[model samples]
Target: MNIRKRYLVLILFVAIALGAVGTYVGLAFFADGTSPSGNLASSDRDLLTELADQQETIEENMGKLSKVVDAFSIIQENYVEEVEDKQLIEGAIQGMLQSLDDPYSVYMDQETMEQFNEQIESSFEGIGAEVSMTEGNVTIVAPIKDSPAEKAGLKPNDQILSVDGESVEGLDLYEAVNKIRGEKGSQVVLEIRRPGVDDLLEVELTRDAIPLETVYVDTREENGKLIGIIELTSFSENTASDFENGLADLEEQGIDGLVIDVRGNPGGLLPSVQEILSNFVPEDTPYLQIEDPSGKKTRYFSDISSAKEYPIVTLINEGSASASEILAASLNEALDYDIVGETSFGKGTVQQTVSMGDGSTIKITRMRWLTPEGNSVHEVGVEPTIEQKMPEYYYTNPVQVEEPLTFNESDDKIENVQIMLEGLGYDPGRTDGYFNKETQAAVEAFQQDQELNVTGEVDEKTAEVLQTTIIEKIRNNEDDYQLEKAIDTLTE
Candidate 1:
C-alpha cells in the first residue's frame, strides 16, 4: 500500500476577544544542525515562558500572516487582471517555494497536481519522457521505451534549449515539460544541445498516445546459447510485475545469462524498485544508503531471495537515473553484477510529495541517495564496470562530420548516412551498406529538397540536417551500439 500523503495546510484564524490574534508554525523546515548524539550539553534549556511572552511571539507571527492575507485580498480586489482567491493562494505558495532556489522543491498547482497524480497512476499521453534540472539546465532524464520520445530519438542528458521555437534557456523543469507536451497528433520541435557536441540539434517530433508499457523483454541466441534481455523503460507501477513475468518467461526459454538494460530508463517509485530488487538481492542486508537532514545514514535492506543463481549484467547510460541507478548500484555493490555502457544520470536526491487539499501538492527534496557501499551516485553517477561510448551521431555525442561522404566512399559512417537517407524518404536505390553512386544521388536529392547547395555529399551541414531529420521517426534497429555490446558481453 502507498504511504498516506502528508500536508502542511494553514489553519484559518479568527479575530479573538480583546483583539487577540492567533497563528501556528510547523517546524518541519526549521533546523539548527545540532548533533543528535547524547553527549550534547543542552539539557537545561528553558522549557517554560511567561504567558505574556508567548502571547507576544504568537502575535508577532500573527502579524506576518495578516500581511500575507492582506496581500492576497489586495491582489484579488485590485489587480487589473482578474485573479481568483484560489489562484492568489496558490501563487503565494509558488512564490514561497521559488524562494528556496532548489529546483527539485516545487509547488504543483491544481492542474500540475492532477497531471502529476495521473502520471503516478501510470497512465498519460505526451512525448513520454522524464526531465529534470541538471546543473541548472533543463535536461532529458530518459525517454520511456516505445513512446513518442524514443521514436523521436530524444536521448538522456540532452539539454533543451528551446521548445517550438520559444527559448527555454532558463525555464524550470515543469515549465519546460509543459512546453514540450501537447495534444495527441500535435507536433513539437525541440532545439537540443548535447554534451561533447559542437552545435545545436533540432528535433521535430509528433506527439502520440503514451501507452503504459514499462518493462520490455526478449530472448535471443548467441553461440547456440539463449540470452535473456530485460529492458526497463521506467520504474513504474507495472515494472516489478512485468519484470517477474519476464524472468519467468526467460526461465522457460532456458536462458544462460541475463542482461538487464536500463539504458534510457528514468527511475520511478522507490518502493516499486525496492520490491523488484528483493527478488535478486539478499535479505537483512543494506542495499542502499540514505542520509537524512542530520547526516545520519540509514541502510535499506532487501526483503527476499532468489531460488536460482542467475548471473546478471546491468546495462546503463547517461540516461539511467534514480531508481535505475539504485538497481545498478545495488546489484554491483552487493551481488557483484557488472554494469556495462556509459555512466548513469546522477540524481541522488530523494523527493517527498505532500498533498495540499483540492488537488494541490508540493514536492520537496528530503534526503540524499547513496549506494550500499557508501558511494554517492548524485551528480557523479554510477560508473559502469565497462564504459562503452556510442557513435557520434547516436545523440550521446552529436559531433559534426568533418569529412564528407561522397560517391565510392565505402566507410562505416557512409553506411549510416545511407540508412538515414533511406529513412528520410530518399531511396538510395540499393543499401549495400556503402556510399555508392545511388547513395550520393540520394544525398543530392535531399540537399536539393532542403534548398541546400545540392553538393551530392555529406558534409558538416548535411550531416547535422540528416541527424535532425533522423529523429522524425526512429527505428528500434541494431543502431544501438551500447545495447549490442551489453548483449554481446552477457552472451560471451
Candidate 2:
C-alpha cells in the first residue's frame, strides 16, 4: 500500500480495535518502527501475512471509499472557497458520525476533546447542562444542580434555538455547547423553545466553574424514622467512592431506610455507575447487560452476595439519564426496590471515546445497555413503581413579559404566571391561559406579599419576582412530592 493507503488502513484497524477493547492495543505492533516491507518480529510478520490474505477484501472496501478521497481532492484543488485540509478531514469525520443517526455519537475536535476530558476529570467552565440532539435540535437533557443552567431556569427538553442571538440551527451538539460555555463570569445568551409554550424564551447565564462533586447525603425524618437520602447529581470520577463514604456515614447514623435519589442527574462515566451498582446489586443476578453491534451480550454483576439490611428506594425523573437510568433500572429490576417519581430520561446506549492519536476523538455509541431484565429503555423511559408527579407549577415555563398582562388579556405567559401564583399559595382561579379578574387578584396578592406595587397586572418586575420566588421554593424542596413518596415508601 502507498503512504495514504497505509494511513487509512491503520486508522481502520485502530477504529475496529478501539470498539472491541476500548484501547489502542493494536498499535503495539507498529511501535517497533518496523516498516511494512522491512523484516519484523514473528508476531508482527504473522499479522502482516494475515492482512495479506485479506488484501482483496481490504482493497474492495478501499475502492468503494475512493469516491470520498476523490471528492476531497476535488474540493481542495478547485473549490469556490478555500478550505483547509484539517477542516475538511474533521468535517468528513463529523459527517460520518452524523450519518449514523445516533445523537449520542459525535466527533470532538482537539479543543473539544480537551474540554470533555476536563469535565470528566475535574471541572470545567460552562453553564453546566448536559445536552443531546433530538429531532435535529440541540435539546437540554438536564441542568446540573446549582449550576448556571439550573439557576437560569433551563429545564429538561428545552430546545436551544440560538446562542447570543445567532441561530444554532446548523450546529451540532458540541458546537452549540461550545458556544454556550465560556470563561467563568462570561455571559452567554440562549434562545430556547420550550415545550407547551407559545413563545421562545431568551435565557441569559453567567458561566462559572462547574465542579464534579456528584454525591450529596442528607437525612429525612419521616414518621419517626430517619431515612438516609443519597442524591447523585452525576456519576463522575470519584462519585462511587463518595457515595460509598456517604452511605457508610449514613449507616453509622443508624438510618432505618435509604433513598437513592437521581432525580435531576444527567449521567457520566459508565465505570462510575458500575462501581456504584456493585454496592447495592447482589451477585446472584446480573446488574447490567451490554450488547455489542454483533448482538453479542456481556453480563455484568456486582460482587455483593446480599442486599442491604435497610430497605432502599430509588427516585427518578425526566432528568435522570444514561448512568442514572442504569442505576435505577438495576435497583428496581435486580433488587426489587421501589422506584418513585416520573419516568426517567431514556438513554440506553453506551458511548466510548476513541482517540485518533491526534488529540481529537470520536465518541461513538458502541453498545446497548440493557436492564437486569434484558429490557432496553432507548426512547421509552424507565417506569417508576409508584409514579409521583410534581406540582403543576413545577413544569411551568418562565413568564417572559414584554407587554404587561392585565385583566382580560389571555396568553401563555399569563398561564405561567397563574401557575406560579397557584404554586406560591395564591388562588389564580384558572390556569388555562386566561387572564381574568381572579388571576389579576392573585397577581396583586403576590405583588403585595413581595412589597411591590399592587398593580393587579403581570408586569416585567412582577413576573421576575414571581419566577424567582417559585424557583427558590422548588430548590428548597418546599413541595417535592416525589421525594416525599420515596421517603414514605421506605418508612411504610
Candidate 3:
C-alpha cells in the first residue's frame, strides 16, 4: 500500500491522520492529489508547497518514512503467519498515540468515538451509571438517579469485580465498560464488592435506553414552607430545557426555598450547567474562571437571574464532579447558598474533542476550570458547607418505622414516615412532620400501587413495606443523607 493509503487507514484511529488535520506534518509532501493534507484548501496547499520547497529536506524525511513502509510491506509479504492489513494499521495507530505519553490523549476508532459521543453529549443504552478508574480500580462513580443501575442497587464507590462471569480486574476502564454495555433489553450482570462488606454482591441488570434524568423536580412543604428540589443527574443535551421547565413549574407553585441535589451525579455538558447556574446568580455576575494551557484566563458571566428570590441549598458528594462542582462552587461564591453533603469529585480539567480525518475523534484535556472566586477544585475537590456521611447497609433486608403513622397528626415520627413515603414514589408532599391532605393522598396512592388496602394512613404493616421498599432503593442508590442535609439547610 502507498503512504497515502497507510495514513487513511491509520487515521481511522488517529488524531493527526491525513484529512481532517491535513496529512501528517512531515508526510503530506509525498501524498498526491491537491496536497491531500487537510480540508483547508489554502492552508493544506501552502503547507504542502512549503514542504516541497525544501527538496533535500523532503527527500531525507521521505526516505526515512519509506524505509518504515518497506519494512511493513516485507513483514506482510513474508511473515511466518498471515497478517491482516487491519491489524498492522491499527497497531501502528495505537503505537503512535501511546508515544504521546498522555493517557487522556487517545486515538479512538469509529465505534469507540460513537460510544463516547453518546455518553458525553447525549444518551446510550446501558445500566445508566457513570464509572471511572479510580486508584487502579474500576469503580462506580454514580448511578444515574432512577436508572437501571440505581434500580438494580448500584452505588457510588462500588468496586466492580466482574462482568457477566468474566473478571474485569485487568481490563482498562473503557474495556470494562464496553464489556458491560450491550444492546437495549440485554442483560449484563455485574459482581460488585461494596465497602465494609466482605461478600461480593451479585447485581443482575437489564440494559435499557437510559432516560436523560438531566433535571428532576420534586417539591415538599417543610415547616409550612414550599421547598423546590431539583436533582440534576447530569448536564446533558436536554438538561437546560428540563431545568428551565422545572424552575418555571416551581416558580408557578410559589416555591419558598430551593434544594438542588447533585449527589451521586457525574457532571455533563458545561453549557447546560452554566445555564442552570445562571438562574441563581445575579445578572452580569462572573460565574467561572477558565485558564487555557497558555495561561490565558477567561471569566464567564451570567446574563440574568431567575425572578424568584428564595434561599437555596445544594447537595453534593464524591460523585458530584466537573460541571456539578462548577455549579456548587458558583452557588457558594455568587449566591452564598448553603452547600450541604460531602465534597465534590474533583475534575477541574476540560476536554476538547477534535474530529479526525475518518469519523474518529480525539478528546484531549485542554484547559483547567476554577470557581468564580478563583478557586481550583481539581484534585483537592470542592468541600461542602456541611459534611454528612451516608449510612450503609440500611436496606439489606426489611425495615419498619418506629410506630404506626396516621394522617393529620403532627409528630416527629411523621418525618421518617414521610421520607419513606417520598422514597417509595408516593410523593407525600413536603416531608413535614404533619401529614396533610397531599400526604394522605400519596399514602393512598402508595397503597394502591402496592396492591394493599387503599388506606390513607401508614399502619404497622404499611410502614414496614414502605420502609423496606424505600430502604432497598436507598441501598441500590447512595444514602440520602446528603439530600436530607440540603433539605434541612433550606428549611432551617
Best by lDDT, which number? 2
* RMSD (CA, angstroms), candidate 3: 10.5
> Candidate 1's residue-wise lDDT over 1-492, tens digit each?
112111111332222211121111111211111223432234444323444555566556665666676666667568899987666666777788778877788977678877777676757777888888766788888887777778767777778889889998766667777888888899998888877555687777888877767788888788887889988878776788889998989998889888888878888777667777777878756778878778998887765754346688899988898989999999898888889988888888777765564566678777787888888888789999988876433542232566877787676566667667766678887655577777878999999988888889889888877775676434444356776777777767
Counted clashes in each candidate structure: 0, 0, 5
* TM-scores for every predicted model: 0.73, 0.91, 0.69
Per-residue alpha-carbon lDDT of model 2 for 385-486, expressed as tens digits? 999999988888788888889999877788888888999999999998898889988988888889999999888889888888898888888889999899
Candidate 3 collision pairs: 22-37, 23-37, 153-476, 220-430, 221-430
Q: Top TM-score: which candidate number? A: 2
What's the lDDT of the predicted structure labeled candidate 1? Answer: 0.73
Q: What is the lDDT for 487 in model 3? A: 72
